[model samples]
Target: MARVKRNPMRGGNKFKLGVFGANADGCLSITRHPDRWMADWDDVLAAAQMSDRAGLDFFLPLARWKGFGGETNARHISYETFTFAAALSGLTEQIALFATVHTLIVPPVYAAKALVTLDHASHGRAGLNMVCGWNQPEFDMFGLTKPDQVYDQGREWFEILRRTLAGDAAFDFKGEFFDLKGVEGAPGPVQQPHPVTLSAAFSPPGRDFAAGSCDCIFTTFTTYDDAKVTIADFQSRVDKAGRQAGIFAPVHVVCRPTEQEARDYYQDYAVTRTDDAAVDQHMAMKKNMSGSHDPAAYDLYRKRFAGGAGSYPLIGTPEQIAEEMIGLNNLGFGGLAMSFVNPKYELPWFLDRLLPLLEKAGLRI
Candidate 1:
């Protein structure tokens, strides 16, 4: 095996890390397999508190108008992301909160207002994860035809967000998908023109948008080499656009204790292959959606599971995971968006066993 090289810039500082809690139970659904697991607002609050105590830097909860993976009935439907962030802001101090917002489903003006509110509520510790809608079924439910021009839609949405959050009192936006006439956004974000804006785009246009506008890009690549190439590609786009390179953060499925223990946990949650119907539904949805079967995307997802790419890098002792994270820091990743097989159980392990190792590695939290 090739030895992983740690980044010199990191010195003793570990990169930032976060978690995903889109599912009610905070578990990644595998097609048809339905597990009666749902996380309540209390769970989210507790998790945030735990992460803060553990010295993690951020906590992100993705937004979905409808569930994509199997386990169809949307769970934890009451707490909208903005509202939840507001509540969490009062509950914890320090950990940054990133709420996902879908551009296709929300107007930019309204989205900006909500995010700005969060910035105030959280004392300027708010961020956004921008997503262009990919679910056709949800569009139909919203009484709209599926948008054929996704790139245009994304660009319009981002432009509006950027402008509105810039504290413009009377900005005009005229685009193919959206038209605004002298719109003003009040209570601009606390973070200067705006709070942190993040995105997870893999296509050429998506990459261009991130390079141009996003402060951070969420990626999902399986291997260090692949991640390096992708980062370099994104940096090139940013350079061409005359913008500084943004932070790169990737989501990982992590299990701990040891590599063998991590593998066992993955098998327990991800490899059982139950719920064929749910799996079929998810696959069908992917098959019908834009960029669903893109060869490169599929290859990355497969590598994540096959251990060539997707295997969790932070799955051993805290020291081990910290070392792996340090390696990624060397590769220029500013942070990680991580998910565990069972957060209720594993999160405690992370705080108790792993966090100190990160501190020892030089990360302040």
Candidate 2:
């Protein structure tokens, strides 16, 4: 393997790491497997504690209102993101907690206050993972209008949030989606200006929006070369604007002592027991709601729920998984977040087995 050079940015680490989907049931995998752990508070807390103790960087929960229909009823159970973040903040000593916000649902005024609420609980460790709504049915659950141009509305929503958190004196603003008059922003958040912000956007326009709007861009990639190209493009945009943004990749790990053991489990769980019906439901939703003409292009999206909605897989032994992380570090990825079938048991297992290799490889401190 090539020597992985740690990122040299003043505040950047070798690579940032976090846990995704621990706060939702089943980790988005539609299966009735015995190993699946419900992402209840106990489950999420266990994972959060392990990640914090292991010095991982962040925890992101997917926002879900309803579950896709299947025998498993995947992701039907969910914790509200801000409340989940607030609870995790008090329970753990470190590790940033990001509340995933469906920007359209919450007004910027209240959203700003809720963010501050978590920031106080975490003493500045709170952040936002803003997502434009993707599932039409999910939005229908809230009676929200499924806009013809969702990302544009998302841009407007973010602008309102951006200005609201800036906390300038009374201001008035009107936009296509939002209108505010004499809005006095909230007073203080522990983080300077505000807490960190992230957005999961993979398409070209979405990538540009993430690069220009957030401190970090969260995305899922299928290949290293593709990710390298996309990351370069996104960072170039951010750099041209005289700002720097981190690109956090999501990966799904199904590792064991040996590669075959891991592959067998993934093969059995992801393929043989794959929920094709549920996967199709999700894929159709993505194409219809996001206005993407080519949802099928996402290989993993078609492949059963690999890790919390098609995050890249690191399915191998601990050594192989560590090597994968090292390769991502070398490729200039800012961070990685992932999910597991059973985080309560598997998270500690991963930390115990993989943290040493990561440290040895110089990917973690």
Candidate 3:
């Protein structure tokens, strides 16, 4: 087997773009009003096909064991992550498929097998987004006793995952949470050792783990200053760990033909949620997990609704959004994980208008 050469200019060259898809039930925005709804199976498959044709790099479908927001209708209560990816792999030809795997909730060996299976299904176009389980209710649904146990379990899970995905036929891993003896994955991922691994971590331990293990780190911040500081902190940690930071940023977007149109659409789609109960529930979850009733984050959230910009700030005219994307590219981010307002309508608009601009800007194919 040949060694996989790391792209030294991967982060600085151009923006590798991707889209976030609906996993099980449908693709619904947590913050936005549940106005647009795509059919569970056909619409999602079509969306994947559209993204592939649009020269998108990857499509990430978030996994949730149970609903988080108060709105129970759009919450995914259908197929599992691996299953959804498998179906998408059959439907789409080029774009990579990423499934969200909660490390703390899932056994590492199981997760590894699932990813390997998806890689085989996709024929080398599979990835994993490793998430440290944050939802307390989801843990309870799994019969877990305490939320604090999640971090320790996640550490152990990653240990097993790193070793097992190496495809070593005889690997021994003994940890506090998981113990395996000479286990190896069959039909190892076509992407060398395994598929691409990603994470979204803001805390110190999370950042350290991402720097050491993940192929990309998914992050979100309200302002450019906040984003710069966050990226700098992560890069510092990566440097201290003697590892290269591959890519870092969130995977959401809002692009339009004009800046006013983009802002109007952003506010109309995201900020106009009529279901206050769902928003409150989401806020409560955020508070409990991170103690971040930080008025700043909320203010930023409001700004996103008000056409200002939010955590994943890629709003403006095509040229302006492209410039922001270039800024991210310069900041050692290898990819943009993007999502649209209403994928059925907005995706085609993006492909027709914004993508051409991005290509001219040397950020896309």
Candidate 4:
């Protein structure tokens, strides 16, 4: 049999680009905008088709079981990631599709099979974002407790998945978190050893886990200098683990014909019409349950959370947004997963306006 090619996410453009959070309502913005992303099946399909045609690098979905309580509840209405990826795999031809999986929520054997199914369904365009579970409320809903050795459990989880995809033969397994007999998966992923894996991690342990297990790391930062520091820190960890992992950043954008118009709209949706209650709920939960941000960010970046779930923001005209993207590329980000207030309306606009700038900057082709 011919060796399967690498997942599109593994390499390509100097700066890869992806559409993030399209599976959830309101994309990433906790806002009261009348036309905030509805996340209906049609809307999700439209966004995926648009992104695929635009030659976007990938389509990444968030794994959210419950909504941050508030007026809009932000991501309350959402599609399950694996199913979302599978559906899109049949519809889109080029863009890679990722399913963000919380290791604790799905068994490793199940995850391995599902990913393989997606890989076959997409003909090797599938990818995985492995998440060590966070969000206590969501955990509560599942009647599961956050294990003390959270990342340790995650490590074991990935090991099982790795072994499961190794071949068709069943094997007994023992571990701190898992014990199984005759464990195995058939029809391993189309991508050789396994499909590409990424993790969004911010804390040291999280970074270490990602560096050790993932092919890519997704991280957040407050400034260019902050991002620089994060890159250096993560690179050190990757080196220590004797692995090479690409670093990706997530950003929320507000682009318009003029910088002022962009800023005004950003203020209108993210501040004036923001879903204050949902942002509060999200902030408090994330601060207490997750190490997904800097400690100072909770208080210092409330508007940021409202704007794009605490991701870095790019608000300006197409040229300005493109420049900011180039700046991130300079800092060594392998790619960006981006969200917008209303992707149904804005994504096409962005493709039409900003893509040319990125191409001219040599970030994409």
The C-alpha TM-scores of every prediction are 0.84, 0.92, 0.87, 0.97
* Candidate ranking (lDDT, best to worst): 4, 2, 3, 1
Q: After superposition, how far is residue 5 of candidate 1 from its true place, in Å?
A: 33
Candidate lDDT values, in order: 0.64, 0.75, 0.66, 0.89
Q: What overall lDDT, based on C-alpha atoms, would model 1 receive against the true structure? A: 0.64
Order of candidate numbers by TM-score, starting with the best: 4, 2, 3, 1
Which lDDT value does model 4 have at 2? 26
lDDT for position 214 in model 3: 72
Q: Which prediction has the highest lDDT against the true structure?
A: 4
lDDT of 4 by residue, 1-365 (tens): 22235566865678999999999988889999886998989888999999988989899999998998898878889999999999988888878899999898899999999999999999898999988958877888888888976889999999999999996688888999899889978898888899889987788888999999999998889888888999999999999999899999889988899999999999999999999999999999889888899899888988899999999999998999999999989999989999999888888988899899998989888
In Å, residue 155's CA in model 4 sits off its true spot by 0.6
Best by TM-score: 4
- Residue pairs clashing in model 3 are 251-337
Please report how far candidate 2 places residue 47 from its true position, in Å.
1.6
lDDT of 3 by residue, 94-173 (tens): 77788888776777888888888887777778888887857777778888654465556676787787677787577887
| Segments of candidate 2 deviating more than 4 angstroms | 1-12, 291-301, 304-308
User: For residues 102-191, could you state the per-residue lDDT of candidate 1 as single tens digits?
Assistant: 788878888888898888877777878887757777777778765776767887898888788887478777889987988778777777
